[model samples]
Target: MIPQRKLSLLSNRLARKGGRRVPEAVLERDYCLSWFLVGLSKTPLIDILAFKGGTAIKKCYIPDYRFSEDLDFTLRESVPFEKIQAYLALAFENVEKDSGIKIRISRFDQNVLGLTDLPDSGL
Candidate 1:
């Protein structure tokens, strides 16, 4: 896991470079978003998931694009909701093991998953 202090330092440097404010919360979210996507992709879910949304645009096309607080994906194939939930659970478990970040799914639906970071996670 990237230390919180390191993330703060990086955000500070980016903010200093462009004179644009870099919110620490956004940095934290971005960090989690990246690791979550990586972990998710390693699962079978990758076959069905298609990355999209503002975050994807920012990552693949425009580094300076607006910061996004969440990850968005579209399913390319149909899967039972129960199976999707199971896959998501596996993904979350993988993320925790790999990144040391405890993320709770605060809410979820067919098209959205809202994640919340546990407090004092050491980033």
Candidate 2:
């Protein structure tokens, strides 16, 4: 669970800019997704091109964006398109069920897929 103090600080910053702060439930879902990716990265099925947004910014971006909710990763060129789609669907389903939000995943290419939308409620 995210520390209450840290969540408050993040909430304050997002409120100041009229940005929606991620809910605690959503944060937990994000954590789960992160670990899933980490585990998958060690496998040979996919290359895990990039895990961008919050974690990436925290580790790579000079001045971090402070908050990010989605996980972004790429598949290996040799991986079949069907497998990529299946993985994303399952990942998004897990996140949506856990967070009580609706997540939509889309592919820009055979190897590049993204979490397109996450509704505020599981609508």
Candidate 3:
């Protein structure tokens, strides 16, 4: 769990640096989602997919990369939608239970191809 003081300090520092208010909820949402992605990456399911884009960079490659609002991946081959959904459902459940942060997953036909949409977390 992230310390409340640490989170407060982060938000304060960010707000000062950017010359604007940094909502603590946004920080916490990003933190929670990143934690959930960490758990997702450990699975064999994700190993078959090629992670890409800014969110992938932030989570998998560059820790200090810029903030990204979305996750992207490329599949070498097709997998059943239900399989993908089930794996993520279990993973998100574990993440929520452990972190005490609810992660809601849903598909909205907003992105092209197989891009799965992450629903509003209501953070």
Candidate 4:
């Protein structure tokens, strides 16, 4: 659970991106996804995948780049599809078991999106 003080701080920080502050639920989801990604980097996925786009901008380069709900990754080199599959499996399994956040991922060519359930949004 996120402490009230931290949530307020995050919300304040996120408010800088746009004129209005982002909702708490969106920030919570982003925080959850970020935690999942931190665990994901431990798997072989980082060796073959390069974090890119919104996720990178928000988490790496700029913290106030808006809330990114999905994770996007690009292939760093010539890695076999099987290895990539294994990487996803291992990473997701570990994160799910640890966080109880069942992140669903879909891939298209060179991009992958991590889909997650909202705080109270049914389905």
Candidate 5:
């Protein structure tokens, strides 16, 4: 499990980077990937709480922010955090391979998952 202090530090860093509020496409991708991963482990989605830029989406409302580059999703209960991380890693790798853009996944817990872009290497 990721420590709370570390998570807070990471969040602060991302916020300071001016990461865009998550976009709808990212949200949809996250939902689909999350369901698939959780289903593989037979975990159920009891609830989802999206803090910050996610409040609108959680409420089934449209988001006001455009160009959102980060997404934060909170699951209802805990599960094997490593498994979730593995699933997300694989998912992001696939997306990167397909889109030719680097995608990175980080998980604090079964409850919290983050997706972000990788810095361009100019390769």
Candidate 6:
């Protein structure tokens, strides 16, 4: 888990040295997104999941692009919704276990699983 102190220090440093002015909230969101991806990469679903949307473009293609607050994914294969839910549960659990970031499924439908970090985390 990344200590909040370190995150704060890094954010301050970036704020001092940049023209774009990245906010702490955006940095923290990016951090959580990174850990979630790490957790997903450790699962079998990684083979079928393709990272997409603005977040993907920001992280992989253009580092200076506008920040994104959510994650988006596209499945490369036809998988059952139940199995996708199972894998997502595993991924969320792994994020909490490995990074101390509690993520909950705030909303769900056939197409999306909305995730939100718990309020008590103070991230």
Best by TM-score: 1
lDDT-wise, the better of 3 and 5 is 3
TM-scores, all models, native as reference: 0.81, 0.41, 0.67, 0.66, 0.36, 0.77
Query: How many clashes does the backbone of model 4 have?
Result: 0
What is candidate 3's CA lDDT for residue 95? 75
User: Which runs in model 4 stand beyond 4 Å of their true positions?
Assistant: 1-19, 106-123
lDDT of 1 by residue, 1-119 (tens): 67778888988898898788698888888888988888898899999988899999988799988999878888777688889889988998999999888878898855443334345
Residue 16, candidate 1: C-alpha displacement in angstroms? 2.1
Candidate 3 clashes between residue pairs 3 or more apart in a chain or in different chains: none
Residue by residue across 18-72, what tens digits does model 4's lDDT show?
Answer: 6688778887888788767877888977777778888789889887576777777
The ten-residue window of minimal lDDT in model 1 covers 110-119
Candidate 1: regions farther than 4 A off: 1-4, 111-123
lDDT of 4 at 32: 80
Q: Clashes per prediction?
A: 0, 0, 0, 0, 3, 0
lDDT of each: 0.84, 0.55, 0.72, 0.75, 0.45, 0.83
In model 6, the clashing pairs are: none
Q: Which regions of candidate 3 fall more than 4 Å away from where they truly are?
A: 1-6, 15-22, 109-123
| True-structure lDDT of candidate 2 | 0.55
Show pairs that collide, candidate 4: none
Best-first order by TM-score: 1, 6, 3, 4, 2, 5
Question: Over 4 Å off in model 5, which ranges?
Answer: 1-52, 55-60, 63-69, 105-123
Q: Which stretches of candidate 2 lie over 4 Å from their true place?
A: 1-10, 13-49, 52-55, 59-71, 106-123
Candidate 3 per-residue C-alpha lDDT over 92-112 given as tens digits, one digit per residue, 9 for 90 to 100: 777777677667866633234
Model 3 residue 102 lDDT?
A: 68
Error of model 2, residue 16, in angstroms: 8.8
Q: What is the lDDT of residue 113 in candidate 2?
A: 38
